[model samples]
Target: MERIVLPGDVVWEREVFASGTWVKDGITYAKVPGMLRDEKFIPLEMAYRPKVGDNVVGIVVDERNAGYMVDLNLPYNGVIPTRKVRISLRLGGMVYGKIAFVDEVGNVDIGEVDKLPAGKLITVPASKVPRIIGKKSSMLNQIRDISGSSVFVGNNGYIWIGQKGNMQLVMKALDLIIRRAHTTGLTDQVAKYLDENR
Candidate 1:
């Protein structure tokens, strides 16, 4: 059973894991209402916040004299300076890059980037990205091997499926993974789904 805690509720009197909690005068309180599981507070609602070193898939939406504005599938757009890019990208082009910095005001800066070929892009809840990749990338590898497609999963929840084999199947499998992410025994469930659909 999980324990539900409200905002400002004391989670621990001393030090604990820093996620989802704030410290005040040596006592840690819940920053958000959430379920306490495994000594971690799992918030009922969570949104993706860009962090440095996270790889992301972005679409070039607008070009500026100094850089390109990229849609990172997040609330804030990321800017990739022209000097940092090796290949020239046009509007609507896709690129894979790492977030280099996020300012205090939430503006994002993208680092070195590689332009990607035309492909289908899908968006899933950012929190479910780990489940899609699975342990040691087991789930992602399985999808690639079975579908014969190059799949790029961005930490920001944007997934790019290269145009290769069984695009529809790969999309379906990804959707299943996203939908069943919270359920236990999900890997087995995905395998069964693939078998039945293939």
Candidate 2:
């Protein structure tokens, strides 16, 4: 029978006592750069992680004089350049942009996707497009007012939303609106429901 060796246990061989150095119970741990010892390594979701030339959906978190912070659903926050956003976006309007840069830090900045009336370059589902536009452009107007974006809906189900000032923020707001609109009457019902529920 052999005894299990533990950390700090001594081994005597050939009348020579070799002091046991402290070793981890199972395996030796290695340190990787930019990683914590106790931190578990979790891979970023490919759907949420931005790849080169991959289109992404994000929302504006903070608007600053220099630029805006975008919630790209990544490990790091994305930055929206002032140049990429339009100058007419009011405090609450919707804007859309294209991913132009992704840094090692996971920051993604995009160029504004302008050129409205050119037709549908960004195509959403036919059913969902109506939700984006809303009834008689009611939802569309709400998106425009809050995101500071100009939204155009084509009969072909093509939606174009441009930024007024900083397209990044407006685009972010629009993304929220579109996603929520899928739940049916989420916009109007939410406010009314809140008033009633509370």
Candidate 3:
């Protein structure tokens, strides 16, 4: 049966919670509002949680002798050590990398850092990132192909587009995907929309 679930609502009886959900007292609870269909829970909205090996988009917020502090759209900021980056870090510059470590309280250490060129930045609900990328990044590639704009999506919901001209169209496509993430054939729909609109 499909039903609406709110935060803290019991979604399952298990020790370990799913990626976007949480566990309390040996029971799983929905961390965000969404639908529970059959035995699966679909989160409609979710915040970014730092995890090792996740690729993220961040903005350089502060510089340090060791490295720099990056705002990763998380409650706690992330850091990139000097050795991982080649360019001179500047305040407000965009960076991309894989999270190398996450401390006990959500602090993250990012690795393989690379500077991203000037682009328009957009944010979406973190839970919708998977839908935006689609299977094997087919949706992302299609958007790029149709719009002819460079695009990068982070697990944290920050998106970078190489150009601003087509970003409006891209955002529209993203909105559709986010709203219909649970639906089938969304990739095909997005592809058609982008091709026709672009």
Candidate 4:
């Protein structure tokens, strides 16, 4: 059952947890304005919160003696320990990795990182990522096919576009997704847009 949920509204009574909701005892409650679909709450707007296993695209904003500080397009910066990487990262380099841990105070630890070559990076709202990726990477694959780029998406909202694609079309499709995400038949619309514009 899907419906518009507001802050503090009880989403479900069972012992389940999902994004944009809080669980107390066995009941799950909404933490923001969003739609509840398939027992998962998707907020209309949100900031990226570090979660274990979420892939991230970040910049090396600063470096410490032990590691580097990464700006993950989140309110808090992430730390990439030197032990996790095989090479030295420059102060302004890009790294792609998954979150290893989020401490109690919101400190993020990144792991399994690889440095990405410099290219175009697009940042969007975290709430829009699910729509951009679509179900089972459908929209993403479409974008990749349309543009001919090996696009990599970070759940935190940083989109990496490779050098070989129709970058303009990719950006346009992403904009179209943000504009029409809540509408039905969005996938169809994207396909049409791509077909007509190409």
Candidate 5:
């Protein structure tokens, strides 16, 4: 017989399964082929639900109300208030936050997490932040202009870049800028090279 599950249960094979499947505390669930039941449930409690105003990590699944709809890894989706965020967020924006409110209608609100000493979100540690800004912000500017992405560098070396529609190139450029920042006049050299090569 297939096992059963309740809400607030996490999927054991998180990387290999779909979201929103039912789970019970301390139990795992799997969909099995043609049996009395399709769900193979196991006891697992790793998945938990977020209470009202509790912070959590979520991905921006949809944008609305000048904010965003985030799948809080819970049974319900949460709203990250635009006011709670200081930047323009697009689909798939990764955010860490606390729950701000859970309305009677099942809508949840999320408040953005604080910026760490590195000046960007806490996810970017201070030690590696400098690599993104480059010396004197030159490489940073190049990334903004070339990728049409808005780049911000915090005084403490935290870097924030905003872009839409597949930002792999922008990400690569930012990484390169930060990694090569220490080279003498690397920004200027790149500028001159781009001018001549193009």
Candidate 6:
């Protein structure tokens, strides 16, 4: 049975609380409406908010005197300072960078980026990245091996597929993973799909 909780609802003591949860005194409370699954609170819905150390795929939308303004696929644009950039990027160029910091006011700082080569870019929900990668990158490796494509999965949910063999199959597998991320036995399903199709 699933335990659905609303904001401010008191939870049992000693239960570990994850993000979107808080504890006051000896009791824990939900900070968002969600279901308790495997002792983790999975929110009903949420946005992809950038956090420090998150690798993201950003496009150079505009170049500023100080640096480049990157589109992080978020509400706010991220700034990649000139000093942090090792290579020059042109407008519309895509790069893989890490979020160095996010201020309290929600401004983001991007750093340590590498220019991506020409490839197909696919975007999925950031929350589904872990499932796509699977345990210790098992799923990712499977796709890479079967498709012969170099895959880069950003923490922000931007996936870059380089090289060309079985591109369609790769995209199909990724779509399946994203669409069914919440379902159980996903790894086995993906593996089976790949084997059968191959």
Local accuracy by lDDT, each model: 0.85, 0.46, 0.85, 0.86, 0.50, 0.82
lDDT of 4 by residue, 1-198 (tens): 668899989988886677778899888888878887776677887667778999899999998877899999887789998876656888988888999989988899899998888778999888888889989999999989987877888999998888786989999999999987767688889999999987
Which of the two, 2 or 6, has more TM-score? 6
Q: Across residues 57-112, which tens digit of lDDT does each residue of candidate 5 receive?
A: 45668977677777654566777677756656657665656666777765777765
Residues 79-154, model 3: lDDT tens digits: 8888766558779999989999998899899898888989988888888898898889999999887777888999
Highest lDDT, which number? 4
Model 2 earns a TM-score of 0.32
Whose TM-score is higher: candidate 3's or candidate 5's?
3
Candidate 1: list runs displaced more than 4 Å: 1-13, 24-29, 32-36, 40-44
Which run of 10 residues does model 1 get worst, by summed lDDT? Answer: 37-46
Model 3 / residue 76 / CA error / Å: 2.8
Q: Candidate 1, residues 16-67: lDDT per residue as tens digits?
A: 7666688878898887666676776666435788989998999999988889
How many clashes show up in model 6?
0
- How does residue 193 of candidate 1 score in lDDT? 84
Give the winner by TM-score: 1 or 5: 1
- Cα lDDT tens digits, model 6, 127-149, are 78878888999999999998888
Q: How many collisions per candidate? A: 0, 22, 0, 0, 13, 0
Q: What's the residue-level lDDT of 176 in candidate 1?
A: 91
Give me the displacement of residue 196 in model 5, in angstroms: 51
